[model samples]
Target: MRAALLCSAAGSLLLSTLTAAPATEDRTGAAEMRGTAVAAARAKAAGVDFGPCPDAQDLPGRMQCGTVSVPLDYARPDGKRIELSVSRARATRKDPRRGAHTVPRQGALLYSPGGPGATGLYFPLIGLLPEWKRIAAAYDLVGYAPRGVGRSAPLSCTDPKRFFNGPSPAPTHPSEAYKRERVAQAKAYARGCAERAGDALRHYHSLNNARDLDVVRAALGEERLTFMGSSYGTYPAALYATLFPAHVRRMVFDSVVHPDPARIWYRNSLAQSPAFERRWADFRAWIARHDDVYGLGGTAWEVLRGYERASAKLAAEPAGGKVGPGQLQGAFLQAGYYDDQWPHRAHALSAYLKGDAKPLVEQMEQHPEAAVEAENSRAVYVAVECNDAPWPTDFRVWDRDNTRLARVAPFETWHNVWTNLPCAYWRVPRQRPLDVAAGPGELPPTLILAAERDAATPYEGALELHDRLAGSVLVTERDAGTHGLAGGPNACVNGHMEAYLLQGRLPGRHAECAPHAEPKPTAPGSRAVGRSR
Candidate 1:
């Protein structure tokens, strides 16, 4: 878990007036010269060959896979190198619309699925979806596993079973003994990562990942890169835009990450606490509205009480000897991520409360203990997040903040704390986070999408990013709670994205779109799903 309003034209004008003009070297002629130099460098570097995709054989369309080698440390390019896995689905249309930028005819639409650690090798599949089919027809949809993720030299610490099956972060009884145990677990996690990853961890920061993206761009023979970054993916994407504005043609950021340099991982978690609580409340209300089917309660508070009791029961006696209080919370946390999941989650909760533990246990089963690939993903996630910026080393600071947060937003506060605790003890040297503020006209216009009530990446972050990325347009999904908004069911948001990607057009000012009506309760035994966009 990680974590805007429209501004008037007058405000936009004021921002543009305050921004500094590009340097003399950043003018058109100089930019073209720089691009030529980059192309020459790319020509000298190792080239990629398109072949059948190794991981996903069933993916629709003509998918090609290749690898590009980038220096592990740009400062010592010849010292060490790592390969990043890349995949692309070529455009289906013969005559694709071109943007106004004077770059090698609008290249592929590159996408990054955020996780800081999430493997993006398969994200091109999104373009194959019916809603995005048209966009896919125009531009090749490209995806790559960022360094330290998936096939790109993944990072791993302890065995997945040992790591995931350890003590719960949220103790039923917050005794001193419980606190000590949690701290011990966090320390062990940090030590294990240090021992397992060693020097590799030092190279897993976001800046390095952004640099890697540039190499991918060059290897693809693209003079300009068009990208869509979601969730945690926004950090590197934003960094890419900041470092190489001349290279970017169009970019879209969804479920935006706040680009605050000081508050990277720790503070970001704290910000998500209230957002999770709010989403949890919404879930409770939804369940209450369907009391006839769930029979959990008739009021939100009543529903919450039932949930607390269930959690307590699971803590005392793990369901099917696997699903415990923490596991239960983890399962429900998905509800916070996407409202489309509410129906299944509600049904599962109803089944659990009605003395049938099978559904709950099934949900727990979804979180396997020995999935090495998943463990690798977590490792890379921690590696990038913990090393990207400084985290408070003092346990007392964590204890105090979490204790206070637990009082008002107990839903995911402590769980989130423990999830990020390893960062406090990360061995890698911290890097100063980038000051992402862009001057007016410094970069091409970008599009931003956010939901008003997203829990993972709260709505406030999108607004902050929109303000920082001068000339950017923020398209809001009013009352929506989903994390990634573009590829989902919201035609309003998707339509805007299509317009920007196909034609270099964005809203004249900040805009908002209403979400679909909340899911109505379905009749018992019906399999209708309430979709969320």
Candidate 2:
């Protein structure tokens, strides 16, 4: 999920001075189909041509992979089409428990890994983990590359090497000049995407993604949608349920996007700025507590000073030349998502200050080939975000809003703004934001999880989504801030999730999980997701 956003920028310092299409082409009349509805009622869903999965050898069940073709434009239904890569980890049996359960296991659990851009063809592989055991037993875990992501008509905006691996500007204080630079690069990137993507940009937003998702569901021959998605993935999943509510059996949205139509995406993206700032504060405070281990600072302010000094050193002479100031900040961003990363990253910073550049440099390494995938992720992220709804055409609105926000909560504010700045110059028609509150028919009980302190999809979203979707359950992870709560460290949350998926009901409509333990000094854990550029 971190990689979904962190790497989607595709370029670290992409800036210049400052950084949408029309109606009538009516492809978004495609959106008139509701994010992913098949406007042509008679259009038959394509069948998936299942074959052996390349990476399924390690899993217990026979994992199958195939491609399903869907309409490139739902409005044009049968006129043209695109492919979606699909995977299925077949459900072998129900829970072989010593516990008594009478309800029959339900249908496939269509899964997306939280990216409006993240590659998800392999998500079914999560069933191999112990945490997913009962889930795997009760349902066929279905995974697919949502439209314009990964192998499914993937979007590409610019040359990968230049956009992803090129040098970034110094992470110095934002001056007028620095702000102008970001604007220029943002325009350049947006223009590049429009020039490169052309007509294809019109078909990649959430509505079309939703339309394609239902086509995939039909291809799998499922009568109802039982789904699980994280972060931005929840947006389309919610749309699918709304677009085709009668077909919705069950759903689990982990770290969800708010669906008030008012928050569509621009406001949603901006909301993350402050959340990241608070999470960063938590990391700094954690560093302060572990001063005995890190010896960098005894207070949060002192710790931030240590980081600033390190950022300055890296800006002048990048550790190992590859890990620059951008790389340093990228490393710090990980602590905003997962607290367990605090110790290792803090140590890496400490080592860099002591002249052990290898720790930080190695932490920031990237294989050259990865740049292409990063470009695809970024392209889809840009296309979807920009195309999902209208953005401020006037750069001043962007400039004012971001400037006001950054002044108070500086962490990630500018970096995040530049990443999505392409939206201001989008080349395709922007759809009216999808209304995900209700479906054509009654919606099923949904399980939405969010950590109170989660920066990616803030707790407000979960609360809002719970309010909009009547009878849905909202589970809070108290005092914790991690994203992607399903199968996470909190057993209480996981327990609620597992019980919901397997038995189709939770103990209560509203629940909360206590915070998971924080990490010990130097404890090895999850790696930082994505990197600078």
Candidate 3:
């Protein structure tokens, strides 16, 4: 949730540099409409509105909380009114001084937390990145949950635990029966979501979310929109630019996702497994050196075998009636996102291997605590991923792809499959995915940041996106393993971002950001992963 993954009212520009602009009155048609909807939706959805300018009285300008009513289906916009829960913190420095009026209206920024499900309505609260406060000072930082996500009309499936702790598509034998069960479980999850969510499910597409951003913009009364999109949010930002180019002012897409329609994300993530396995190996080697602390394995190979054994143990008897292959794999996926958390995972693996069971038990306990948030997570994730393109209904395809992938990348292949298995059964109707190579849709100068070694959204994907975004400047965090590449606070990456957001300067067409120095030892006082957040 720290990265830009949540949805919010309107779109935004990534303003690194600042400039002065006129401070207008507090009236906004967009704000008014949003306010009305917020009041109404709050009555129905029981969402918190937080009203206007709550704690910002100390600040200079006003902020508001509200919602927008969108259709359950874009084709039938006039049909059922699906509520988009939203919150806004308007420009605070706009009216402080006359000479500073131009600078006062620092404009606003819209952020996305990428889950299509993660909520960022609390961007300020999330305190994303140590430097975010500086960014928020000049601009209004606004965020919201997409439909079927936090505070928004959420989706809940029966036997929700099954979603987290079910048997995945992986099998040691890779038998036809295994594939059948995988497909059945996937399809059942999809049907369960569809049966409960119905029309609400259909409208959760990224395109719709992008359009909802427009409505948010209109409601906010902003002349233009600025955005920071990561992961799946990149799709909506791209789509919004294509659908309404004029509305966009500036945008930044991090950890870019392939907008191609032909490939299912399940397939794409499978492709990433090898890369993650590579990262895990690196982690395991490090853990070997620190065996005195972890004791899970005496060598990298031992640690590797330990994880395999843990997976086998879970497959035989899921921990605490949960933490099956899916949960274990899902947890690993989170761990793999960055290097700082590797120790946490290593410790958990070590403890589990020793049969202490506390760490793994602790991990399972955290799941139920996040149940509501997890639903929001699953809802938004499936909504956008499912709608982006049609997934093959044939379970045989998934079975084949996953089984083939698990051969070399056994780490999370089946686990990844089960994590995304619900997509095969997504209740929402499908739409065409965006073309990654489709040139940027008349966007303002955008900064594209990519890790040279990102596994989730591979570096090549960024290169592809850069090629498509004619006005964008691409920078590579050379050899970095993490996706998105922003939180390192490296002088090369952060300086470019700061220069862009504050000065509106674009790096040369292809900028090469210096790689971070070899990471300092992970002992105490070292810069840990997500330290910025």
In order of appearance, the predictions have TM-scores of: 0.88, 0.89, 0.79
Q: In candidate 3, what are the lDDT values of residues 293-318, reduced to their tens digit?
A: 77766788997788789888987877
Model 2 CA deviation exceeding 4 Å by range:
1-46, 54-61, 94-105, 170-173, 439-441, 523-533
lDDT of 2 by residue, 1-533 (tens): 44224322321222222223354235335444642455323223446677787665754456889988777876666567777788888775655453445335577898876667887777777877777777877788888888887788878888888766643554434778887888888888888888887787787888777777777777777777788878888888887777678777888999988887756676777778878888899999998998888888999999999998988887788777777777778778867987767777888888878778777876775557788887888888988888887777776766766776676567787788788888877767777765677632388788999999998887888888887777789989999998787887789999999888877777677898899877777722334332121
After TM-score superposition, the amount by which residue 87's alpha carbon in candidate 1 deviates from its true location, in angstroms, is: 0.9
RMSD list, candidates in order: 7.2, 5.6, 10.3
Residues forming the 10-long window of minimal summed lDDT in candidate 1: 2-11
Model 2's alpha-carbon lDDT is 0.75
* Better by TM-score, candidate 3 or 1: 1
- Candidate whose TM-score is highest: 2
For model 3, the superposed segments whose C-alpha errors exceed 4 Å read: 1-64, 90-103, 126-129, 159-175, 264-267, 296-299, 313-325, 364-366, 422-428, 436-441, 517-533
- Identify the candidate with maximal lDDT: 1
What does candidate 1's lDDT look like per residue over 149-188, in tens digits? 8889778878877656732434633777777887887888
**Candidate 1 vs candidate 2, TM-score winner:** 2
Name model 1 segments beyond 4 Å from true. 1-40, 43-45, 94-106, 166-169, 366-370, 520-533
lDDT of 3 at 183: 72
